[model samples]
Target: MAECVACKQSSMAQYTIHNVRFFDFNPKAIHCMSYDDATSRLALSRTNGDIEIWNCWSRPFMQLFLPGDNDSSVEAMVWCQGRLFSAGLHGFLLEHNLASREVTLRTPITGGPTWCLALSKDKKKLAAGTERGYVCIFDVVDSGVMYDRALEKQEGRILHIAWHISGDYIVTGSVNCVRVWSLKEGRVARCGLGAADRKDEVIVWCVGILDDMTLVSGDSSGRVCFWNAELGTVTHSVHTHKADILALTVCPDQKSVYVAGVDPTIVQVSRVETGTKKGKVEMWVKGIQRSIHTHDVRALVVTATDRVYSGGVDTILTLSYFPPRTVCKFPALPPLGSISVAREAESLLLQYSDHVELWRLGASSKKGGKSGTFLPVTKDRVKLLELQGKDDEVIQWCAVSPKARWIAYLVQGSLRIYHFTPPASGKQPRVQRVKEVSQEIKKSHQMLWLSEGKLVSAAVTGAIQVINVSGSKAELEKELTLSPGHSVLQMTCDLEGKMLAVVDSKNIITIFDIEKETISVLPGHSSPCTAVGIHPLTKEVVAVYADMSIKEYDPSKQCYTAFCRQHLNEPSSELAKKHSVILRVSFDPDRPDLILLHNESAFVVVQKDKMAADVSQEKAPKVKKVTSGSSPGKGAKAGIGAKFSVIRRPNQVLLFSQMKGEAVVSVELNPLQVMDRLPSPLKVKKYGGT
Candidate 1:
């Protein structure tokens, strides 16, 4: 028995990705990544304006997802102090607090999209490079900007920025040269140009500071150049890659630099001391034969003395270790429409473009012949249930019950509910179709489970339907009708499941009292409403409109008491304009004062009362005042102070957010807190379940 158990344990450890606890939607390219040694967290920015934070040391590997600007791509990200600062194509800088899980807009940069960012060692200075050949510097304190400075322009777009460890100098790489700026003097301290004889001028894409007086830069011509920053002269240059060098990370000892770019290869450059010259060191390339990445490497970080992490277009995070040189890789989930975790069952519910699949983890055993012994084995992924349909039948939305017994999914404007039961022994779980309801509405946009046997669905036709599933067959219990020409765009329910808030095509908000069978419309928006959310504890309804306006409705008064408006300037590109509509509005589950407002170009979080004071008319609503406390009889607000949200993004973006907060029922999940605290495999009994 001991031998069999040991063999099984060995096989599981060898095949499983123990370090990779959480995975996001696959296929979306990773644009940038940063590692904070202090927090032991890895932050990744993807092409779809989604940010993912992973705690490397946490058990079950905690992950957090912060939603980005709708349709906007994140250009750069960096971790400094206790905050994650990110820049995107919208030209705004975002500061995300690791502790509070709150995001705030720092400032907007001029010239154009900020491509690269760097923070000084003292955490007081920040430097950003813009696409229009300008470098901007800011005095940062507690993730807020104190002052700003725009340095002199160079020849081309600034691609990369690196600050000196001493906090006095910054090096920026641009089209044809590398320039070092002195923050104390606010001027160019030194500049090094590329070779003038070459036919094509080299574009500097990445820069790394080796020391206070030394700088290393990589260019499009694949040349790595070492320069003496104090003297403004190149000391050595070597060809490193086949094409542009996109990322570079310097070792903690300052002895070697790891480089990766357009090519799949990762090369290490070390400065070797020469015996003949006492003060001179020659640069040599130590190449790794195995390709660690399948696509262009866009980001690199040195996590420790011997460990490095790299991610890129391939959507894979690779960990490379030195000395003996070992590598481990983690791949994201295959590009899916949506993903949800059934925490109690240790199962993953995934929605693909054409099908829905439930994956479960369980223990299996194999008999060792002639020994009369059974070896305990573990199945990493077992497809317990799969639901597939025709190509045109796409799943629009899905929801799982709290007990993991009922699953509801919407396909082609119809709703389907299934009852799931795990097998008694080693058979596949049975997924029995319990209910199917067809609707004549144009499109069913959203669905939510009010209870295990009850569901509420909203359609674009301004109709809301309540279905009951407790009687073996699904039946339409209540159908609520709205005013003509008003199409429901977004809908949300209160924590108690008694009040439903709906945003309509005409920019109106309708609050429905489920128990009383009454509806009230709150008047205050100028443009069409896009998203709506209800506060769990206070029963406040917040709505966002296409004109970038936010309003909070007081349920007791049936009026808008507070409002906030976001003033977005004219868009720079056609793509930006196409996605300019307001996408979502939500309140922080823990803090009712904090509200998240998202548009196509940016995600802005503001304090509700403060925002009201800033942009709203406090006396606009003439209604009776009511106490802002939790009510007594209404099922004690189901998810009070629970960290979650319902704002939906693209498939990949939503999946990333769901994976981070797998244990919570929120629109957005906080990475700092999650409920997936499964015991370590080593602590489980030999034949026990995961």
Candidate 2:
């Protein structure tokens, strides 16, 4: 626990918290990562071939997640011209369509089982280093990949590949040497690595290139070796690690380099200038280093966001800054918005790469328990149904109807609807798939269920389509136009599902009327809105932005509504400024004036009753930061007041739901649980140590 803070909720002391720590979030190790500076987006692949595109601006948000199946795997990935390209042991070159959220192309690799991928400086040529020691180059044109040529075959597998700034040469690391391949002359030079006595001691695992034709290689010998590839000579070699090096990333400035490996520590090597100004001696010097990961790091990337990110078998994504304020860890929980709650049925729908699980929440006899103790179960939680997609399909969106009778999900532009009935006593729940869903509603961005068996979908055509889902059929009812050429990213509705609030990609927030077929575009913000929620009591929309700013808009009046004029001052608070992108904003039905906002870590509770009023001019409200719980709890809506308390979750929160019970559900990913399933970690047994 962190600390205790003052809260505005007088009833929070009695609130029942269903801290669910049993949900199995089987996270896979990160295998590769690629970053796009233009979009500030990072694309990473897991051991299961699942790929997630994270918006790595103010926060690393999992904007898009593409799940993988049993036969899929990814070893390397590259982002080229706003598109994502990945390769793996499957021997296929995959180019994914971000708009369609699917694999648009899968070209087989002739080199067999690609181990790495690199893009040319011009972003026109794509290269894949494969198991058969062949470098295959392809042409990337207009969102497509076309095979071009394969370089002369070498002796060993190409484990890593990197391109020169001029795009004239490609550098590859293999079994015991690093080779530089000239586009015209094939393999121009090679620098052998490792000691003569050890065969596989110097396995080159990762490689990079400098502008001056200098080749950098990280190998199994725990060394960061610099090679003059043009002349096949070793320029310098530094043993920066005590174990094998696995990942290396060059800073944008090219003056600094970050390398990490089995030692689990990130080492910063900088180009330092020594001696006098007239005769300066430049060398790469070992600078300050930080140890964040507890296991080997396989993927490392440094972005202009001033944050260096690394991930590996530990399944934790760590972000560290240079001077170090605090190291933030994005736990390997299913993407934040992936858990959908069915309040009426007291159930939850958890989204995975290839499947969706519907679990009926359990109840305890008591309301609250000790901080570290588990409550006695009155009713056992049940996994009602696990709906899995086909081999060729990847689940994109999933939702459970408010009543939990209808479960709908989208897989690669194909929609599937299921009718579910919660079991009675010991009876099994009935699950039936609707075969006659409307064909026209297949290509939608997001889908949610409203009241009266009405399903609303945000179509790719920038229209909200209403569908009537009956016992075994679903039909399109009406299509209301939203913002043209813009896609809706998130959608929320009131308890009755009457008032719909949606935030689009263009940073616009719009309220759509279902029965009236009308649209009210709220005065939107300039920054990207991360979440939007409607207060069930007041029907007011609360929008949270990337900069940690909050706004409340009234749809009926088409105007901004706020008690305190200093509401914008919330982001200026030290607590709010440190938070990540606000993923969700929830309103308590009983306390509509209280808005509950949370990102990846902390929960901000705002109460309007104690709002700071501007008698002459509004002053900034007082801020409270707490790690430990005192009398306060997690049930707060949005408000601007002196009781603006930020409650930081002690562990990485997985899912928090407000259901029918007087309880708050807290699910967290326990690292020990994951470690139990993994093999024994590599360890040096200190005398008598466990």
Candidate 3:
């Protein structure tokens, strides 16, 4: 054992060194020991299932009795009045009375040996830790035992215990963790000892309550660390034990402490004389190994009579009267405010900062007080990926390829491909470098990836570039220039990437056979074709006209048909029916049957069959409502009476129409939301609408 330089109490040695001796009356292993502050009586558990009670004030007041002959070994001991509670392996709990030496047994607990045991300060409840790595609380009654609760947090066994000063809560060390639990709430208050690093692991074993909201724990490495509960801080740490620390106890005056372990011969007395000053403890060691027992010492207890009681493998009770000394050094670390625990492969992860962190949980835990170690969570740990574009060359739209491995980005005047790593790889994300080879075309407003690694790029200059990307290097295999006055604007591709459909400067859609490298422009609409999409599985091209009309191009019939139209037309026959035009058209990637059409004022959901029915049913309402005449009565007018009339316009139903003109004039109408003013024809038509 070693002395801590902080929070030490100064105590002088009262007993002489010559007095250290042991009386070997019994020969058995000691499992657990305890002291009753109220009665000044100390209880000791022996390997043969016997408990030895000693009156610390008396020189030779020691009595031994058998509790039970259970097969399991005793793990912990708690005392109340003349009764003793013992937790043993295989969930064995035996109660024995010192007065009559009568043994009474309670219900079986969980599984394996009880790793930790604690009795409330008032002796109203008893908590037992099981090898199953969970905590069970039992209420202590006069006649028998009653079930209380179980704590479910730590993934391993609990090994240490320390009750809060208020007797309202308790903390236990288990599986490299220190957990605080509230008796009133019946839940975990906090868990500590977290690590962020992926490597070094630690566990907490024995814990001692230094004050109301402060405690200290000794881990497997024989390190004693202090923590404050209110403020999360590790004030100090001292390596005090050469072997695992078995137990910890606070000094009577609440200033000093006593620790015992493998070095049985020497009992280290740590006294805090100076307040948080370095080298404050006046260190002294007493040869109490022989006095504790004839065998290895396992447990120790401090009695109210100012005497120390020890139990060991020799099954003997050792007592000594020792005086205290004052020693002082640095203060202990503050208690941890919060803790986050996570489980990783074979290791437990712990986080102790304001934010949660990730770590691997280690295997071993000392006496149970180890809060596993963890690292901090920082922004640098997480990376972000972003793609930027030029001022006017904004990314108008984006679509992932059929395989979901490649993404096609449509810019103001060009197309780009980005290849991404699949999720199965479990590696950092990366994007492919797009090879720009569209020099033949001034600029592509849109592009689509077709089958056989072919891409069709459309420019506003009535030119299209068909490039093949099957090879590592991109090659312009074909170029298709549209007729004069025909420039492409929006485009789409089918699911198999076999066919490409694009809307040109005029309200005409051009369907191209990617494999055959052929393009055909189908003239059908009077206004510009604002958007284009295709049925991925069916290879059907869907075109949206500036008049809000959807037309499908039938490849076998080689004819245009009214697919669908929005009922948003004004009364003026010259004005187009579609308000502000359909700016975007897309087919549901997941549901091939659904099509989405969005414009400035409204959005439309179109299905193949429903769209056909909507178009076929388009017809003007016949009746028109109008005020024929209004006459003034006597209450309305005492003078000359007058008649008034109001005219109501008939609602015009939008139906299928043909775009038969010399040149299919198409214009990319600006979305109404951003348009400064409506066209004179459109404004006049809107005023004439019902």
Candidate 4:
């Protein structure tokens, strides 16, 4: 923990990196992320016109696909009722329905691109800021637009907006100024143009409304400003990030504010009572530190449960915990090109453009490091293989078998499978293409191993083909065809390998039962289906659609139920709709109920019973809830109906729990600690001398 000189009078809160999640899609940049307090879901918007939603506790649940040819990057998104209202580069507010999986409505608004958005506390009003310096306010009811008004213009694009908790005012950040708008008057109430001493025009990148009504704004100048929301004057300002501050969030307690941005640092600003003035409080930088993200931090949301979630340019999602002050990292996915993870071999195979590289994870060292130091030592990394392709052709997708003995990749609309030979005594292993098979399938998009000898593939021609590889020959076994215009997007097989779930371009989930040799089409989505997964325990099919909706289809019942509807209250319906389409769903190997959903931006972990309540009622063991205060904003509602609690541990800490007079102990070892214990030549160098 780094101490802030200005916060000497205040006590700092310890924060650690809890978890990091990496995205599969290579986004140019992550624009923003919004958290729904009602459903505990997080929505992420990217530069590629993609919006994704994740169950706050689980992986990605859905993604929203643009409805028309005018696909523009989403700039700002807000949730209302059961729909997501997004304004972006297309200059139109798109209303996406989570239940129906469709763009229910689209309305043209002022400005070429809407940059920021905020929803009122009561969920009735919405405010959007645009590239043309206009602030648009709208009345939302029953997931439909009632009316909209564009306020008087500012000078530059509106980059950030936050509605006051009271729902009477909205604070907006734009080029060179921060302004407060009155909801009742429908006009600007107050405006602060930053420090008069500053000569350069500062672009405000993020804003947050605190509990005490003070407005916090982070700008490109790397300064965080605190203003009196009503008076519209700068109360205090502090230099925070080294680069642009892109993300900001107010803690539910209202006592602290979290900020992150272009720099890798995350700063926590807290309000402390002034010693000289008994009743007055001042903002202080209580904690400042860096996380594992290697790039610009773009989006942040402090959930109602008090956990801080951050998404960054590195394509990773990091969770920061408070009491333990620990950080955890989750990587979204392998880069967009071609990549495959061999869990059993502990290796990663990646293809960038025309070059392929294989990386192996080294075994953990038995050594230990100094008690309180974190050093960046290169872990055992070995580049085992490199394959170069023709300059014009690139690997589009790739997959490795469970044991990593067989490798398959797609290039130039052709699928190729190769046998990987392990290195023998004093000899290096090599890869050899089996045999050239006739191209019976046209335009292959994705391929995966169904078994050690079987491969499943989806193509643009709306066909799912299963191929059998015996020794050196490849033979097509079966081909399943969808409707003429529907193309396969993603596919996954059940744990038993008897069933396969396929999501197609037409937003339908098709389940192929191997035993019956029959296909059952589950139709409910309104947009294209991105991903599908079969529950390991119950074998129910959970499908994520482009309109940001997640549904579970029970083949036995022949019925579909909204996955997240029962877990969240009515207010969260709007949040459920604001998520992007879910690109993938994965079940934990050890826990069948634990599912991970991911898209381009972030991934979340959710339990089956909590999300798919219609499927089962076997509840997870409940833990004691902890609270900071009796007030609702405090810890009163934190994780109110949550199924899981976050636990953080230090590198050397041991936790002991007592249940019914029985003690259970768990020990955790940090990866760095293991590396430090190793007698490696790299550890002999001085700390700062290169």
Candidate 5:
């Protein structure tokens, strides 16, 4: 309900778009990360103690999450023998259970406030560096991590630690110097970093060990130094960054080293063999550098296959491939939006990590401004309800009923429902928990509310649960179990919740009739279905495939609509499929022939009108026409192919919801606004520039 930009679109009801630009969903910064090559899984810990398990096989999909405590924080994380472990300033080692999405074991370290965590090459021991300047070692046992002993104490805090592959020595980076400890003899071999002067102490943030026993360290002085572990002398050093280097990683081939930090650039150092006066000498030199981030990069990892994964204070996960020069930026946001809107009541539900809030949509200026102008606000948004979660579990999904009479949210494996009564004039609203939910409903992974007071949910096994909720009672109505092997990839429902469309992993579309308790399959397609929607008026199910082709199904007729057949067979429609992956499909109630499909980047409004079924202009307002041809050689003409218009906006849309009065609201967050809230990035002096 923040002050939004109001845009008037030419369509059947002259719809207005509430381009909301005040959605505040700031993600936490990444502190550290670890990768397991065996399973291709990544364990990333945020500034908060929360840990996220990401599947890195084909893509970075966040599979499981372990919520953190209020007073806790994670400083470092490491993966050990397929087991995920984290240590933080809380001074305890944590073992996470992926199945339960919780911490299974917590063992305190011998020293105070662990600052760094490193796994040994043998995968049998873990070393924890502490703020008290001690390196504590632990044995990885079947029971859990058990404290073994502590290394010799140093003067400064142990900011970083790295274990050599030989297991005979370990390297530690501290305030003013880097030290190499001989584990076999239990003593320090190297005691200095060759600092020109000790007046201004340099803070070492990260260190790594290469296969050739070269100690790599990045410090506050913007230097990447390679040290000879045995001689404790610097071999080569380079000023690769403008600020402190917070992260460093060595490739498995021992040929490339990546260093990044406050400067937000990843500088690659490659091993080069130079023919010197004496003989061929192996040397390290700075190579290609990519400015991939906008803020400090705190974590970097190079997998066995040479894939680079990096994250930092900007809350962005970047995947990089060197030779191909391929870099993809993945936002840290979850799949679904944390915000939901109640169309009828005009109320918004905001979901946070530990709580949920209900806010009233504000009023806009009667005289709307231009498309991009910030319309004047008539009323400020007001807060109505704040419901704290029962426990410290991340709220996966939350929704408010169409009329704002109910609210449902999923936390962990539990689905909680509450009766939300809108506030009357001069009176406060009320929220009461609707208890005794069916066990099947509690296990649901997603939830939706129909206008007629019915709740639809999908379980982990792709099963459907329909529950009748009213006042303070929730009764199980029906449960439809899907086939054992089919996994649901996308799900959607109509206004009345009668038609539920589910797309499986195999690109099959299944429509369920909630009232009749029946199911039907639509004609299959070659490309996979990316999104689906149920028409509110005509009750036709719409499916959009990976190739950007679309289809309309008559659920009642159990066949494809004639209009859909034409769209699929037309060769001119190839332009529709070449955009980004469409994630959501929104229908226009007034113009049933038009559908709005959107990804995170842009909106696509596809007008699928049959040549014979075209409505007269007197009956409905004419839609804005697109004159551009779909393809290069195709001529622009009406009633020839599927005509679609693409609208690219400036902000990223977090939520898009349809209302009753032919109006739609798109909650967007500005990129500049997001950066304004982040910690100030390093400002480097340019050559003759402001």
Candidate 6:
């Protein structure tokens, strides 16, 4: 619920359709605001007087903070003529160079309450609306403040103002009528907004002139009215608020109108429509909290994508997501990380930095609710999966056992296993740690199952330990050490679990005959090895190293067979500096010849059959002796700081055919935004459920 300035909580009934998730989108107040010249960027002021520019697509592009002055609050902002203009309570009115990140303060519009600003389309003139009912116009390019005798009298404690597209006329909205003044004329051409015959209070708060012949204005009475420039008469009027209307703007296409008011509601009306009743014109009202102004909507600006930006009392701004004929709404937050469909539980699970959650599918989230609709689960049906004994470990990888009754996780020193039992009644499942395999292996890289009950765990110290968790006493069955001198980064076993492949820091992958207890070393890698994969059915192995090299090794032939170097979309010769490190690789279970490799910025799916023949036909060196860098007993102590605990299934590679897998769902995480709180100043408005 949105808390009132008086500290009262909004009644549940009053906010039954409210979405708190959307309200917290931005936790900061919005000062000056503007849409870019192309309307594809949004710029706003931080309390520190710095300006942050975000692409129209909801991505932040750049930030410009004032260097010397730290506490200036930007009260006004606008983008025009390829530059960003900002003014604030400080004595500074600055023009910023966007491309070079430079700042130049024009003649200081020094005053205590400068709060509003606008720029002409041609970029020749700048206007600052101030707290004293006056506005200052400057020649922007020349850095001239234009304070000649001709410009002094027009100054008043102006609340809001707008520049004509031609840059010849200026419209200033005060506590009364809309004043349209021509620069050359130096006088108001019309002031008919508050004629004696008009019934509404004439405290004009904001003005948005649509064209030379028409304009719109909002006043203290919470009423909005359209005016005809040619006739100098009010054309139509609409009661848009329960309180005073503070800000007004024309829709993107100028076919309709939008007004923000003290009621915390933004009213949209067709230019030709008139009425204050509900559903008369499209309308959206959401609770807003700001201390400086009570629900008093302050700023409004519309940007690309029919997005509307509104700011108010809470000092917060909101961005509304409105589609076509539907009222404006906001994006509902799913659980945290990418969600995937869970197989055993038949639910959607959310994964984050340290948590895994299960959520029951909601009725509306199914195809049954709407054709082609994909909803993960109901927000209220979420459950947290807490792993015992894995409290401070910060799990990095996890795999479920084949049976799905147990989960295997590698922590620090040893392998810890947890057993899960499905709920007998309509309750959550109970999970408990029932098995542990202690290994002196520090920083385990990968863990895979050999047979139904046997598992292989690879450590960073180039050692592999085979553990049997079937009996009461969990114990290691086999221990194989790679060079014993180099560090192991990754390891994987063939589908039959007979051959194990381990890659060391020197990019050398040593193949071990698990049954024979022997090793075959393959070298020639210039970078640290990152990923290795073995065919499930075939004894063939595919290794991808740090130099971005991919090779196929055959154990049966006892040699390297083929190399697929520099496949399609390879980087340019000059740009291909240090090779990219391969992070992960996997072979398709159904298509043995199809391999997938994931690197830092690229994902490649290749067919092994089409790969070129091995370039490495050279005979490899044979090691007649196995010598540990510091001897076996001393190397064994390398696992001193290693620790392990079973972790819940990870969502990264959701469903690996050969491994027990979980489902995945999608969630969004863009650090909280302040503009997401304000009502979009222009076209469409989005709505969230009550």
Q: 3 or 4, which is superior by TM-score?
A: 4
The Cα RMSD of model 3 versus the native structure comes to 38.8
* lDDT agreement of model 2 with the native: 0.74
Expressed as tens digits, the lDDT of each residue in 1-690 for candidate 1 is: 001211111111111111112332234667898888886778987776667775554211224445443445688888777577888677878787532233556588866788999888877777889988778887777537764888877667888999888887889998788999887887888988877888888888899886646899988988788898888788888787778889988888888888888875788888876655566656555555347776788888886655777888776677777667667665443321255545346455666545777765443354332211223445444666778866556564567654457787766556777888866677867777874444433245467766567778765455788877764577778888878766554466765678898765454688998889988888754455556777766888777554444566787877666342241122212112222333445443555566554442223344444434544442223222121111110111111111111122211122211111111111222222221221121121336665
The order of the candidates by lDDT, greatest first, is 5, 2, 4, 1, 6, 3
lDDT of 2 at 410: 77
How do the residues 1-690 of candidate 6 rate in per-residue lDDT, one tens digit apiece?
110001001111010111111112222344456777464567766543445554432222222222213344677777765467777777567777443234645556734467677777777677776766566677665553454222334434667778888777777777556777777777677765477776755677788877555767888777777777556577777776766777776766766666777666776766433367664663222222212223556667765455676665455445664554322221222211123333334343333324444343222222222211223333443343645333454333454444345455644324665565656678978776644455443445456666545677766445677877654345678788756456544466665668888765444778888898877776565444446777776767777543455666677776666433333223222113323334456554555655655432222445444332221333213312222121111111111000100011111112222121211121222222433455444232348633
Ranking by TM-score: 2, 5, 4, 1, 6, 3
| TM-score, every prediction | 0.51, 0.88, 0.39, 0.53, 0.77, 0.42
CA shift at 104, candidate 2, in angstroms? 1.8
- Worst 10-residue lDDT window, candidate 5: 630-639
lDDT of 3 at 543: 72
lDDT of 4 by residue, 61-155 (tens): 33332212225567777766546778777787888654333466888777768878888888888888888888888888774776578888877
Scored by CA lDDT, what does every candidate get?
A: 0.61, 0.74, 0.48, 0.61, 0.75, 0.51
Candidate 5 lDDT by residue in tens digits, 1-690: 365444433333234566565556877888888999998888888886667776665435554556666766888888877788888878899887554345679998877799998889999989989988888889999889888888888887899999999877788999878898888777687776646766887998888887777889999989999888778788898999988999999999989899999999999999899998999998888999888898999999999999889999998778888787878776665445267778877778888877888887776656544443455667778788988985656676788888778888987657788998767997878889998776546475567786546887766656777889877778888887666766555567887767888776455888988778789898888666667899899989888665666788898899988787754454224344333456678787778877777766555666665333443332323334343221110222221232555555556656666766756777776666668889888888789999
| Two-way lDDT contest, 3 vs 5, winner | 5
Q: Poorest 10 consecutive residues of model 6 by lDDT?
A: 7-16
Whole-structure CA lDDT of model 1: 0.61
What TM-score quantifies how close candidate 3 is to the native fold? 0.39
Question: How many clashes would you count in candidate 1?
Answer: 7
- Best candidate, TM-score-wise? 2
Q: Kindly list the per-residue Cα lDDT of model 2 for residues 425-493, writing each as its tens digit.
A: 989888998898877675775788886478888775567788998888889988766555666667887
* Alpha-carbon RMSD, candidate 2: 4.3
Model 3 per-residue lDDT tens digits across residues 305-380? 4455565544334555554431111101101111111111111111111112222211211121111111121111
